[model samples]
Target: MEVNPNEITNYATKFINILIDYSPKLISAILILFFGLYAIRLVNRVIRKIMLKRNLDPTLTKFLADFLLWALRVLLFVTFISKLGIETSSFVAILGAMGLAVGLSLQGSLSNFAGGMLIILFKPFKLGDTIEAQGVTGTVSEIQIFVTKILTANNQTVFVPNGALSNGNIMNYSMQGQRRADFSFAVSYDTDLKKAKEILLKILNDNPKVLKNPAPAVFVQSLTDSAVIFAVRPWANNTDFGEVSSETLENCKIAFDKEGIRIQPYLQELSKKNS
Candidate 1:
């Protein structure tokens, strides 16, 4: 069948009229989108500047700025779509459902992320500080969004989930300005208690690393069947806790040996017989 020229012209005219009727709406939507995006960008920039001026962390500042920008853009796009006569309630419902699904799937990770955020905001511990959390003790090397990295005393890197750490007891040793070093030693019953105490006190007093303000405590804590137990407690800087503790023990041994104070061993047989 041959197409009529008049009929083709009529079809073209109808299509052009439809386009003309929708053109203004489409242009208005495009312009709104452009202006909305620009406004979002400007708002994000202002937020970033304020955060910087307030001395916020760079990572947190960037995250907040980006999140705000994306949220604004999405809202703008939704508005633009609604202007073009598209229903957005169903779209919002779909988005909500998807978000709920994702949240359920990532529940553990999201909990950890929230815990990490709390840790950062509350600052229970910071990088390079020695902390004990979730039965693991180490120096915090980094604090991320989901996990905290720790460098153990033995030079091992350990990753602890932030959720467990935040919920558990956290012992931040570095937070204490000073630490106590408790050293105990057992001496033979035959040894003079006064003499042993004097020797230990001299040893501690000679150690320059020990704090002088708190002084040193040396006393007979207990008397067992085989020996008399003496307790020596000294205060030292937190940084030198391990070093001072080890050195104090070593020095006590040397001092006792020089003073002829023999460390009494726990003899089960002798104890049973005495009992």
Candidate 2:
């Protein structure tokens, strides 16, 4: 059969005309997508500026801005796609499924992040504060989004996840203006309690670091088979805790020796040696 050239030309012309007619719509869609992305970027910049002015934490600000910016961009893209005559129901469903999967996979991490935010907002403990949390006692070095960094008294760095910290009890020693230095001294049952109490009180008077307002407390806390346990509790500034504790122990020993107070020895050790 002979080909109809004129008919083929007519069909080609119609197709070209159809494409020309749809060109404006195509251009409009492209413009919408570009403007949507630009608007997202602009919004992110505005958020960042506001956060900076408010003196918000840099990490949190960045996280919020990025999260919001991406969310806005995705919304805009979806709108653009729908405007371009694509069905968005399947897209939305796919996004939902992906989000659920991600949430499940990162549940622990997300909880930690939330816990960190709570910790930062509440100001429970700040950097450089000595705290005991999650069974670790150390100076807080940094509070990150997922983990809190601590400098241990032994000079080791510890990274504790925020979720565990937030869930557990926190003992902030630095928060207290003054801390009590508690010591238990054992004396022979025959030793005079009045003389020992007087010696302890005199030692407290000599130590200028000990706070005089609360006054030092001395009492016989317990009577064991081998000795009488005397409790000595004194208040000192948090900064002077270590120094005051060591000094109190050393001075107590010296004071007891000078006052002729005898320390009770371990009776079990004597029995073992004899056996």
Candidate 3:
């Protein structure tokens, strides 16, 4: 076998020429890639600061920033590839087709993501809000891209899909700042209606937690076979509602006992009728 030294030298010369011609583009592309990444980070920080200064929701602000960061990175990637003299139209078409395929395969997940975006943009409910939706009542703990985490009264954690939550009816108890506590008490037919109303109203007035603006009321809601049903409605701040109701009930029972306002038992009346 004869060694072809001139052929090997020609190959080496061609390689050097290709490297010399490609070096500028390669170096420039690398620089652009690094600068683009740094710029994306800077932009995200600026946008986040602006959003926070405007008092936007923290969850929403972070989501938007991340979305923007990825979008910019994708664009920079396209630019980097194009700088290398590689065709990008076909590449972008491939990306678009892949995205469409992914979107179709994840229809339900995409719906949830869209719902999350709507929830963030529309401000339906915020973190720590006590809301009732999808037959569940709990305080919102976390707002993610696909699901909302809730802490229920029974200490159970629930993850609710944003798609169903956004489309369904939501009752926000904490939004109004105050809530009305409804109580139904039964008294014997012979009991003094005026005196019962006075006692209930006095109980509400004495409680500092009860709101004074709406004014509490006690009225006969209905007449049952065994007793008269009195409706006691009181208004209080949402935070104080439970305590106010509990204390009011306790005080009312004591007052009723001291004043001889008889609360008849339903079974006792039925037993007497049978006897």
Candidate 4:
């Protein structure tokens, strides 16, 4: 190669001039980037405190905090790059394209994720709540980001996807603190409906688990082909609901036996057959 001292010197001088012009700017950008990151973290902590004090749903609070932090960091990075005189439009376009691709590839997963977010934010039910949803009735043992786990009374564990759970009808039995025990009792049509009502009332009144203020109700439900049906409804604390219901039925059978009251159809048919 032929030696070109003038050209080499000119290239070196241009390079030095460019570095001199950009050096201070690069330092400033670097300082701002570090400080901005620290500031973002401080702001995030303050946001967490505010959210906690406001009693914001914990899931929502965590997600919002994380999203905001990432967004702020992205903005800070863009600003730092722009300070170095680089265009940011291309970066934003690339980000949008990536997001679109990811969304397309994970449609079902995204749906479940969004559903979970809705449930957590809205709080239709919580752990320990006995809820009926998606064709099962159980106590909510756990609520995860994408699924819910329930323990059924029959000692079965069910895993329901959040997408279905959030969209499905949820019947929360434990939220009300009290539950109604509805019992149907039948006597032969020959038996007095009034006496049956009295016996049912006495059974309900004697049970300590049954509520008082709302009061128990005993009413003639229907006159079926085989018997006269009576409906007994009693209110009890949710914790005592099962016990109250079972004990009431057992006691009623005993009392009816002593009082010569028999349930409809069976005894009547037996007596006719004996004759």
Candidate 1 residue runs with Cα over 4 Å from true position: 1-49, 52-70, 76-86, 266-275
Q: What is the TM-score of each candidate against the true structure?
A: 0.78, 0.72, 0.91, 0.75
Clashes of each: 0, 0, 0, 0
Q: Predicted candidate 1: what Cα RMSD to the true structure? A: 6.0
Task: Report lDDT (Cα) of residue 258, candidate 1.
Answer: 85
Each prediction's RMSD over C-alphas, in Å, is 6.0, 7.0, 5.6, 7.1
Ranking of candidates on lDDT, top first: 3, 2, 4, 1
Candidates by TM-score, descending order: 3, 1, 4, 2
Model 1 C-alpha lDDT per residue in residues 1-275, reported as the tens digit of each score: 99999999999999999989988888899999999988888899999999999998665676678778888988998999988778999989999999999999999999998888888788898888888888788999988888999999899999999999888888887876777766567788899889888888888888888899789789987887877888788778888778778888888888878888898763111100111
Q: Which number leads on lDDT?
A: 3
Winning model by TM-score: 3
Superposition TM-score, candidate 2 onto the true structure = 0.72
- Runs in model 2 with CA error above 4 Å? 1-88, 265-275
lDDT of 2 by residue, 1-275 (tens): 99899999999999999889877777888999998888888889999999999998666777688789888988888888887778999999999999999999999999999899888778788878889988899899988889999999899999999998988889888886777777778899899999998888888778999899788888887899889988778788888878878888889889889888887762111100111
- Lowest-sum lDDT 10-residue window in model 3: 266-275
Per residue, candidate 3 scores C-alpha lDDT tens digits across 1-275 of 99799999999999999999999999999999999999999999999999999998999998999999999999999999999999999999999999999999999999999999999989788998988899889999999999999999999999999999999998888887888877778899999899889988899998999899998877887898889988778788878877887897789889999999987653111100111
Q: Rate the local accuracy (lDDT) of all candidates.
A: 0.83, 0.84, 0.88, 0.83
